[model samples]
Target: MDKENARNTTIFLVCMVALLVFYEIFVIGPREKQRQAQQHAVAAQQQAVAAAAPGAATYVNRAQALAGSPRVQIDTPALQGSVALKGGRLDDLFLKGYRQGLAKDSPPVELFRPEGAKQAYFAESTWVGPALTPGPLTQWTLASGTVLSPGHPIGLTWSNGAGLDFARTIAVDDHYMFTVSDQVTNHGTAPIKLAPYASVQRQGEPELSKTNIIHEGAVGSLGGQLRLIAFKPWKKQGDTTFTSTGGWLGITDKYWLAAIVPDQTAQVKAQFRVDTVNGVNVYEADDVGAIRTLAPGATTTSNTRIFAGAKKVSVLANYEKTLGVPHFDDAVDWGHFWFLTRPIFWLLETIHGYVGNFGIAILLLTVVLRGLMFPFANKSYESMSKMKKLAPEIDIIKKRNDKDPAKVQQETMALYQREKINPLMGCLPVLVQIPIFFSLYKVLYVSLEMRHAPFFGWVQDLSARDPTSFVNLFGLLPFSPASVPMIGGILDGPLHIGVYPILYAATMWLSTAMSSQSITDPTQKMVSQLMPVMLLYFFASTPAGLVVYWVASNLFTVGQQYIIMRRFKVDNPIDSLIAKLRGARTPSAAAG
Candidate 1:
């Protein structure tokens, strides 16, 4: 048994090392190279854009881009930016409620930048057709209202020399939605055909989370079905079109979204496409309504709404409910388990309302979930405690049938049946936890509410990885270990385990060790012993909030198991350690 256990441990260690090496080579290295290449390409593109322009700045910043455009200021309770009057484009925007970082003076979260900017992203609604229609460089003139706000609406007008006059009225809510109403009146002798079109365009790719859990690219709901194409896939496809009535399309980041919503009752043709401009990839999501012929002395109007801001669940749900934006809440990336994830988010948000802290809310949410699953957990722990009590009998059976594995298994089954204990019962709690774990993970990863949320000491951003690294001695060291030259990447990547991850691993070890004490099989016992260590490495880079949940859950499970084991008078790790400590103390007391 000793030889077999040692061999299994050696094999396991070798496999783990091999897996890590393979992952580092194939996954991390390529991703890092690709990211660096993208950054360099974007910088080169910006330099080229600046060079190509006549006497433009060497590198155009956001302020420079905003100054380049003739604009109308956008001021609202939730947003602050401007409308580029050159195309009447909703181009420059920043979320007032969110910041780029947790610093007290960090800039607000920028949602849009104008065409001349490094990462130009904007939304525009216009008329398109046979007759001269308003285009991006149409040079619109503001015809009404000054600052665009919740109550104030602005009007922009442009007239083609061919006698087609276009008028657009832009209005915004206190939140993220912008209503663009376009009217075109033909003043020519002949009738003209025109169609309403709306587009959300992005010039270059922004830094993405690159995680599979949360989607960050072109997302839409067409014909009441959700469609998602990630950035790489979106680039590869080049162009994707859908014909549907009452749907929305947009580009989404993990927490931000820029979407165009056509009239819910209107039949529209929408397309998600990517174009390379001067060697830079430009992604666009656009929709156009059916062409309508305007007779002489005829006036037609079209209304389209654009959503550009943080993906707040309440805001998206309100728009979906009140404005009939189909699947607007899908912008949050609820994943395959939306039923559970959405409810979990709602519960977390609800709890947060009362507690006034998302960290506390997460703790309370875990407690509630565990309480709901208490019956199953109770049964599982009871069965485990009972099995621990039968360890001696099982050991005896194994030793008696040492050479015959079938006889050992048969006797073990017989023993379990006699004890009225189901050996598989322990798996029930773990199985139940899988979906809940994934759901809560999704909530923490994707929900805007969890972003920049704080837990207790050292966790300022729940959505981000734990900032306290063991390599830096949990921030007590003056110098950052990750800042070292040669092995910095390694230190920052895998070896940068954090306090929460360590706590979680320790709790998991305790729970797993307690459970494994009853296992007589060498391989199974070895696997159980290594499970917590593997999980510690795996979860080292996950969000601090998720680690908090796992630690809390493990501690709760340990407490439950301890109580059940004590009640059953089963030998467990806690009691064993306590008895050993007392034995050591007894010798010292006798010596004294």
Candidate 2:
């Protein structure tokens, strides 16, 4: 009967695994393939547009895109791009320092693409009123400098046929901020009502690494509140409106940002909107400034700013302090544990500043954190050591109360009280570190400063998954197992635990082995032995830096337990094994 039941359970488990594999292969696979096909079709269409408008910047190349429209060049310390004269939009922007990859010849990161281009993204400013106003395709004459630069600004001028004249002055500093001063004069007989508006828009869902832990979509700080809406949520709602004073809104990628900031003192309306344009998903983060009435011969000016480039933490915090852009630093998704996450970033940043390596910084951070929690860990380990020394007594107590589980537990509690060793003390240390562990992961995953930051050999980018894998013989094999047939994704994804993760696993197993010595139950022992393997898979896909941190933390734990157990005079298996080997070698040396 037992054999038959075991066979039945095995069959059920096998069937469930097969069903999951089939569901993934059929149901999930087809939908992903369809999405990719649609993306390819869109790319092909854009390529056709590029062919029609040869050498146009919107076609493919940034230079050609710049040539497609009359524009003023944007030259600054960190950004290189152009402002289109038509519609007076800030269309093209490239981060001069950041590259698309680690290679020397890789293209610089392109933050903004021009209109009519694939994944077209740009920022525009306009006046909204009852009558016809300057819209897309409206020609605006360049009235001032040939380029937009610090100490030099560009002015654009246009007039509606009804005698309302408009002019906008655009300027940029040494960094990412672009200030726009919009002026309008009503020359007609009747007064005209107008509102200044700005929008940062993308014609399609620009490729996103949609990691749920780190936000990678619409981000805004309005009414002193920070709002993050990911792609899936934005697609469902289509549009969201917020009324706030002295705030800004924008579309954000993981490392790059393009936001429109109204005057710090002005009350404004902001909306995050999405729509299907030309069969492509278009998303926009727009803000409308105060509405003003321009009497005949009256000119009113509205001033605002744009941030378009890498979201460097220091630069953003500086902008927040100087420009008083409330909570501008909140743009970097600090997660729910902002209190802990922010300080962790600051500490890591400070240590990296001194140590000159992120990996070393992580090690030092682990040391500091363990030192901070030394009291709690000492208590836990001391209690555990007491438990280890009391294991014989515990066994006797259990055997005496073997018939009643509740009586055994009650006796165990009484024994713990008499011996002044709390079994529950072990859990307190883990609870405290849980939030810290998650915060460190969030910093590694979201903070732009860590993007592409190198550690040591084999870790050129700490924010990326570990590169070496056993299936590829840690890169000794010329090709990838991912190129294999039918089961490539499974092998390449879940089964891709690499070198650092293995180190993490080893440390975890050693630590767990040392700690699990006193837990003699067969079932509990099995669970403890399997825990490190489960953790290896759990942490396999996390950033390499996070893994390094975990390994360092595990080592610190091992070090702490060694010290505390020795202090308590408890038996340590590692020390016992080492002493036994030493004792074996002593006799051989004397005989020789």
Candidate 3:
């Protein structure tokens, strides 16, 4: 019994390690590449636009609207504010510029017209109290050294004056790329060290750099999510060439959060670079004068613009000069199975577009994928069915070798050969699909198409858990609020933690129950039961879209198993094993 247990343990350990290694190589590696490609494409587009239009600085104003789909206004009575999303994607913080560093009690970026400045639409968001008093927009400063006073290009700046500098007209071509630009000049007597940085920050969330407190505990890892960072470059001496700083850009998705960064030194004159290649935005930042010992009145120039937006792979591919940044985007970490599973994501997305329903699309996608893999699953099922049919004969052999452990294994192997059955065959199909399962998870988690998408009653927000209750008793415990289970919490707390998570947990349990019934192997049976419990605790607060997929996938697998078993007449192998145990308990049977 000890020897048999050891062998089983070894097999389990080996399988897990194999799965992890495969996941890192295929799923994680591709995700890294995707993020890189995205960065490159964004950079190239900016450089290309700069090269094409010398007067692009005219379009470098701030406060320009996001490219597609006007922002949606969110109305809440408790808070005297509204939430609007630009470009159909919402990160942890909404505004990307300096205004994001303002007080936390601010609203989304909006119009701020001064008494008599340029009256240009520079991007910025301001939050005036309910009393409506005005002063220097506290916690804010203008990067431009224009005469500083009240009503001097005042309120706040968004897009870093890019909107004031540029004119935006929808392209006639059927392509989708958004671009912005800005120019920086050395007006000072002495050279000012300059660097270009970019960030996409959502309100009430963390920023995307080492300097920000929000970025603490979220460094040096991609979190298997998309990251967009601007690359800052310096100009060489006589060559006057651009030298890439080549700093590492980080990506992590914790709730409504993601960020990116670049390397820069002292300030320098700069220009905005924009490239709209086949309707794709390429954003770049140039910081000149890294090593130059500026004369008393020396001058140099650099520009910066960013293709700051969603991960639309088709659009990004058009910009070719980003040194492969656009291609290296990241999807959510779904595990190691994404190589095959991503196809399912594409399929689900495609169907969702036509049907206008993500849930229905997932159902259809699951059906199609299961159908394709049916043959392989069927083969494995058949092997197990045959083995079950020979169980009585195998029991006799086991009884004969009851005193000899080695002989028991040898006899079992010989019996399997006679029956043309391979015990491991039952697990191979599972092994092959693990990565695909995880990849699908990544797609489901990162794709913005499912945000706020609904499934059914109680599941109105597919991007978060389906709330069923409101008590948050767990919140008072020592456990981390982020790591707490289901919808239950402090009913009287200041925060209104929703009730959808409890429903999500229930649905997961139901799905797991239905799928666990069909597994014949004791070890697999245990895993089937244990894994869902582990995941339910892990994903209680995970994005609703991910939990939705998990619940749906589990239910679909259960239905598939039911259909396969009924159509093929495969018996429950556990029943006979139970019967054998029952017989062994009888005194006469035990003596025999």
Candidate 4:
């Protein structure tokens, strides 16, 4: 029966792998062509819209485009970009500390692209009223400092023909916050009502990911409630609006964010709308301040802020506390496991702060986790050890009632109860470790800090799959193994493992073998043996940083198990395995 079950399991795994291979070839292979065609249509529509704007030229090189426009240079420790003088728009920004790769000369990560670009994303502000005529392209005259960098506020002034004096002051901080103060003095004979409004809009969806594990589109919070508006599902949701006394709404990319923050103490209207413009998808999030009527010689001012930059956890948390932006730190893709992911991130970051190297921090975190779980794990393993020592008696009981199944079961239960052994206790450690493992994986996948970060030796770019492939002898050979036939892609997908994954496999296998004695059921033992090989392929395509964490975790687990086993004088499989191999080779050695 055990042999039959093993055969069936192997067949199931093979069938699953075959199905995946077929799906990759027949389904995933054709989507690229359709995606490209859609992108071209979106670009053509955007060009038409740009033709009507002030700068009719389509977006070009970021440097050249920035130079073409009258601008106020933005210089901060965390941001380097420009504020367009034409419309007083906050665009053309790059994350100063993030780069395209590990190379020093690699360009900084460009966060905001201009309106005429291939995938235009930016933020704009304006006044909305019956008498207001200020549009997105309205040009304002610079009335203050030339540069709008950190700690420096710049002002712009414009007077409509209708007797309204419009003044705008833009101020940015050392981080990602931008405070905009707008004042309008009513000089007309009659009173006019107006409301301040801000918007963050992106032209077309930016290649919506196929996976739903991470949100990659418009997201916001209103009335202390969080909302995630997926790009693909926006058409179904259609123009969702929320009214709150004070909250923020904005679009969020995987690692960066741009949120419209209204005064937390005042009432505002926030909306997420999808508009089709000339066959292009325009996803936008906007907030409008409450209407206020200004009489002649009366002045009205509205203060609002925007957060536009990398979604660093600490920075977002600080902003939420100081600025009262609701759940701002939730912008980072913590997935559904935020409960576990948040604490794990805080602990990992705290360790990294002291160690100064993220790789080293992961290792220390593994040790700390093992130490914390030591009490429960100790009890579980001790129970398993007692069961292992009772194996001989259990086998005797089985043989004594070989002809009577119920008698055998009764004897085994009696023996188990006499020894106070509970088989369920053995599974407790695995259950406890599952969430920690997943949460760590979440942190490594979505956090920007892990991108392009380096470990010692050749392990650069922790957020990417390991580039080294042992099939080419890890680049020891001049030729590429991918040149081989038939199963090359498969080899490259699950078998193209790096040194870190190999280390992970080794540690996991060692830990599994150490606990082999507890898996006395032949079926369980067989599955345990197969689990390590399956894990090697499973982890092969995961980020290198995650593999590092797994390897460290397994190593700590192995050490902890070893200590407990040694203390209780339990048998270890490493020695038993060696002895069995030696015995099997004895006849051949004697013959030689």
Q: How much RMSD separates candidate 1 from the native structure?
A: 3.5
Would you list the clashing residue pairs of candidate 2?
Answer: 56-64, 56-65, 57-64, 57-65, 58-65
Candidate 1 residue lDDT tens string, 1-592: 3324434664576477558755854587568867889878968766877688765434467788788768899999999999998888999899999999999999999999898767799999998887778888889999999999999999999989888888999999999999999998888899898889999999878888856788999999997899899998999878999999979999999999999999999999999999987656899999999999999988999999999999999999999999999889999999899999988999999999998988899889989999999999999889888988888888888789999978887787787788898777777788899899888889999999999999888799999888878888898888786688988776787677899999998999999998876666677677778777777776787889899888999989999999999999988999999999999999899999
Q: Which ten residues in a row have the lowest lDDT in candidate 2?
A: 1-10
* Candidate 4 local distance difference test against the native: 0.80
After TM-score superposition, what is the CA distance of residue 255 in candidate 4 from its true location, in Å? 1.0
Instruction: Specify the highest-TM-score model's number.
Output: 1
TM-score of each: 0.93, 0.89, 0.49, 0.87
Q: Scored by CA lDDT, what does every candidate get?
A: 0.88, 0.84, 0.40, 0.80
Model 4, span 1-592: residue lDDT tens: 3323434664465456556645544455346445668778866866777777764444566566566568887888888888887777887889988886778999998878776555678887878999865776777888998788877899989888899999999999999999999889998999999998999998767765444557887787787778887887876678998898887888887788998888889898889999876555788999898888899999988888988999888899899898888888888878788899988888988998998888898888888888888888888888777777888887898788889867876777677788897766766787798888888888888887787777787888777777888998898987665676976655565567878888888998898887767765676676676667667765777788889888887887777777777787888865677889999999999999
- Predicted candidate 2 versus true structure: per-residue lDDT over 391-437, tens digit per residue: 89878987998998777777777888899987767666777898999
Judged by TM-score relative to the true structure, which candidate is superior, 2 or 4? 2
TM-score, prediction 2: 0.89
